[model samples]
Target: MLPFTYALRNLFRDPSRLAQTVGGAALVVLLMVSAAALNHGMTQVLSASGSPNNVIIMGAGSEESIERSEVHLEAEAAAATGIDNTATILGTPAVSGEITYQAPIRTESGKEEPALLRGVLPKALLVHTTVRLLEGTFPNSGEVMVGKLAHRKLGIPENEIAVGKTLYFGNVAHKISGTFSAPGTVLESEIWFDRNDLSTLTQRDTLSAIYARLDNPEDFDNAHVFTLLRNDLELSALREDDYYSKLESFYAPIKIMIWLTVSLVAAGAIFGGLNTLYAAFGSRTREMATLQSIGYTRKALLVSLLQESLLATMSGTLIALLIASLFLEGITVPFSVGTFTLTLSPSVLITGLTTGLLLGTLGALPPAIRTLAPKLNKALRS
Candidate 1:
């Protein structure tokens, strides 16, 4: 068997070609890692913040968004019985009925953005403990609460844009009051206001969703049935996890768009890396031939070439992962995980690493084999 040095030296024997191969693979890996991180960030938003015990009651036929649904008040009242007050320590129903809307908003810096706003009752906070006021107090009637995301996007300090000041959604200016951050879920991207205030401002007559906590985490279906059988409200009960799954399906197009972009971009890099490996192997044809010309077998040379490709691919993977870990540090996308920070978990890192490994193998093997074939003998004889 030849020394490992032999394989390493052959790869960089042509500096320019080596750069081309490694650099191409690096670009491909970088794209995939970043896209994967972003997609995971989104998936993590709901999965991380979602709870098995929590249930979201939305108007039937609302699909993934509550913005489209309008529930009747009496139906909502009837569904309240599903709550086990004994299960709620506070002697109140562990439920929150609220409204969610999408509004075009801008920062104090004059940058316009669109975000979803949730107008929820105080009980909603009790129901969803993941939500907490990280900075200021909760919004009161005629007042509003903004999330940390709104802080950045709106270019305002944490709930410090001068309380009593007004933010316009459409034509009405809702008074600024407090701020809150919900853990891991997409709620951080949301701004909240008093349901009563929102109703008065929009002149809306009904709530969009009713969220509740169950006595048993496993009773999601039981609670769901309790809500579903109500004769009054046109309610649809969904376990939070199941609800988000539907939401993910609803947003499948967006995820597909990201995947498509990554695929198209990565394809070029894959091809470039493949060519680099082929050329690198071709340049080493005589050396590989020399090895085989001596006591070394063709299989050993092939193994060496495979090792080189794998090493290069591994290096690119490490590089991409480093960038993802450091740069993607605290990216809070407009989604939620339970009441926690949407972090880059071990799973995401594993996925990126796996992707890198595949990139190395797929990009390097075929060309390496073709070059290390008996054709090396012909080249050496030349």
Candidate 2:
């Protein structure tokens, strides 16, 4: 077999070609990282938004969207019976009546955007234990509390959404009374107000959903059974975690579309890479023939060629990871409901590297095989 030095030196034999191949591989890897990061960010956000011990009872036919659901205020009163082993705070059952609305909000710059506005009774604080007030006090009538990511979702500057700032939602000017955070939860992208006040303003008397915390996470069956018995309310009960899992399915198509785009572009890159490999290996036909004549087997020569290709591609993979860390990681992607920060976590990094290695191996093999196909005499002569 030839010395490993031969394969290593061959990688840099043509500096310009090496750079081009590495750059192309880096681009393809970057595309892969982008797709994986996007999917990861979105799916993680949804999956993290729910708690296993929480239960949601929303109007039937509106399981996918709380804003479209309507549960009577009476449902909140019956929450304790609806869920077995309901959690309690200060001797009161942890239950909340909530109303959700998408309202047009005017930013400080006078630009208006739609923001998800959730109206909740005080008990919501106990039921949604993930939420914590970051500053100031909860909202009163004619006042509102903004979530940490609400400004980004609304396309407003951070200063404009701070406590004491005034934001116009519809014709009513609601003062920003506080800021709240529920890290890794969708609630961090909504505005909160008093339940009665929002109902008055939105002209909706019905609550959107009833939320309750249960002592045992497995008590969801009791909630479901309760919902079935209350035929008058036409409500459906779901475990909060299970409900959020459904959101992943709801966005399944978007994930598919992202990968579809990457597949198309990567296919072009793979073909271009294959052509490059063919030309590069084809140029070394006589050299490989000489090695074969020196008692080196075809398999050994193939390993040498692969080592060279992998070295270039792996370098590109490292470069792609660095680029992703600097630019793509933690990028905020806003959607209709909220925003999620793109993360280049370990799994995502591994995926990018795996793709690069596969590309290098597959791209080089066919051309390398074809180059070694000719008779030893003919290859040496060529």
Candidate 3:
């Protein structure tokens, strides 16, 4: 077996190659790890949206956006009756019924982007614990509420956002009022309005979907069948946590892409790693020959080369993870998983480290074996 120091030193023997190999591997690992984190972040946002006791009621087929679900007022009324008044935030009713939809709004600065719009009673603030007025006041009629994202993507202002800023939709103009946050939620993607106001703009005169809060998640066991029973309802109920989980599933393609990209880049990285180790050994064959002549076992030589490869790749992995942690912290890219605020989770960190080690072994073995396999008899005369 190689001395640990000996393996470590070999990687730096050629400073230029070490830099090239480590830097390239760092870039590949950084991207792969970050992408994995983003994918996990999406899942986290959705998962965090609800506790065990809360539930959501939406149109039968409306998966990603509750905006697309259109339920009648009576169906909403029945669900509202089922609220577990006990768990309500601040002693209010547990259920904060809301109407959710979307509208097109132009920014004060950037290009036009559609803002997700929601309508809720004042108690929605009290009911959804995660929601609060980050600044300004709650919305009023002809007034609008904006998400942090709405301001960023559409360049709208929330503080200076007026009570009468008109958001022009299809043929209607809705007013802006105040700002609030249901951060890390589907609500962050939306603008709030009076449900009646939404009905006026879209002319549906009914809610798209109704969201409910419950005291315990178990309250939902029979609720789905109940919601589905009304022939006229065409609505389904789910635990708020579960409802968001379903939404995260919509982003499965993004996760797949992350794996696909990392797999491809890491494949190239494996080659680069192999090439680096190959060169390290190729330049030292004379030394190897001498060692063989001195009675060192070929098996030990093989182990040494493999050890060196592991050292270089593991070093590269640690560097990648450190850089990822320090640089990528608290960064939230706007993505919608129902209402989740997707951010990297600890699980993703572990995944990156595991990949690095695996890449090290797979990347190192081939070249190590090739370099250590030569004959003892041919070289003495040469």
Candidate 4:
């Protein structure tokens, strides 16, 4: 068997080739890490956006989109009844009727971009525990409170919609009276206004949805039953967690697209690296034949080739980790509905490492086999 040191020393025989292998592996692993981070960031945002203890009631036919749902104001009161263990504050059940709209708004810089507009009563803050006022005050009539990541979602310069700035939506102008944040949740990219004001502005007499907090998440079954029994309200009840889970499913296509891109690029990298390996190892055929003549087995030579390949790929993996940390870690990516911070969590790191090892194993096999296929006399002559 070839000594471990034998393989280690061979890596430095051609420093330029060694560098190419390592650099290629690094670029491939970097793409893997970036793709994994994007998936993690989006999944985390969807999973964390909903609270288990909250329930949403929307019009029966519009379960997929809150903006399309419409319930008479009386539906809020109807849905609030018959649910046990409901959360309450100051003797009022933590319930809110809300409306949602998506429209293009002109920022202070006069750049127009689509923004999600949510109109909620004061009680929404109590029901949605993730939200909190970060500065100034809640919005009043003719005013709006921007979410912390609203500018990112709008693709505008940071602080361009800061407090006291005016933004034009449709024909009406609204003041940015405050900013709010809902950490680790999708609510951080919405603009909030008084529900009545938004309804009047948009000519909407019905609410898009109703939110309620329950004392125990288990009571969601009762809430669902209540919605089924009340044909009068024409509403359907769904647990907030279940709703967000559906959102994850809804974003499944985006995830597939990301994977498709990575797969296509990684395939190119693997084939490119394989060609390089063929050239590199093909040139060393005589040396490998000489080692075999010196009592080294074919398995030993194959293992040595794989070891060198893994070493280069692992070095590239390390470089990818550093780059992901420096650039992708904590970077905020905005989507149509919200923004999420790219995370370099342990899971993402593990994914990158696994991809690197797989590349090394697969990339080294063809060349290693080709090098050993020729008879000893033929290899020596070559």
Better of 1 and 2 by lDDT: 2
Worst 10 residues of 2 by lDDT: 75-84
- Lowest summed lDDT window (length 10), candidate 1: 333-342
Off by over 4 Å in 2: 80-83
Rank list by lDDT: 2, 4, 1, 3
lDDT of all predictions: 0.70, 0.89, 0.66, 0.89
Question: How high is the lDDT of residue 140 in model 1?
Answer: 78
> How do the residues 1-382 of candidate 1 rate in per-residue lDDT, one tens digit apiece?
6688877876677777766666666677777766766777676665755677788888877747678888776655565665443147457777778888776765444545566778877777877778887655688776677765665444455444445556776655667776566666667667788888777766899988877787777777666676567746667777877777776676678878988998998887887777767766777677777877678877787777777777777777777767766777675444322122334577767766777788776766787677677565596974
Q: Name the TM-score of candidate 4.
A: 0.96
Of the candidates numbered 1 and 3, which has the greater lDDT value?
Answer: 1
Per-residue lDDT, model 3, residue 128, is 73
Residue 110's lDDT within candidate 4 is 82
Clashing pairs in 2: none
Candidate 3 accuracy as lDDT? 0.66
For candidate 3, write residues 1-382 as lDDT tens digits. 5567876777778888777667766776777778777777776666767666666777777745666776777765576565434355554555555677655665433346656667777766655777777666676666667665555434445433444456665545556665566766555656777756666776786666666666556667556767756657777776777666766677788789878987888778667767776887666766777777888777787777767766666677789888887888666566532333334466777777777667667766776666666666653323
- For residue 198, what is the lDDT in candidate 3? 66
All candidates: CA RMSD (Å): 3.2, 1.5, 3.5, 1.6
lDDT (Cα, 0-100) at 173 in candidate 4: 88
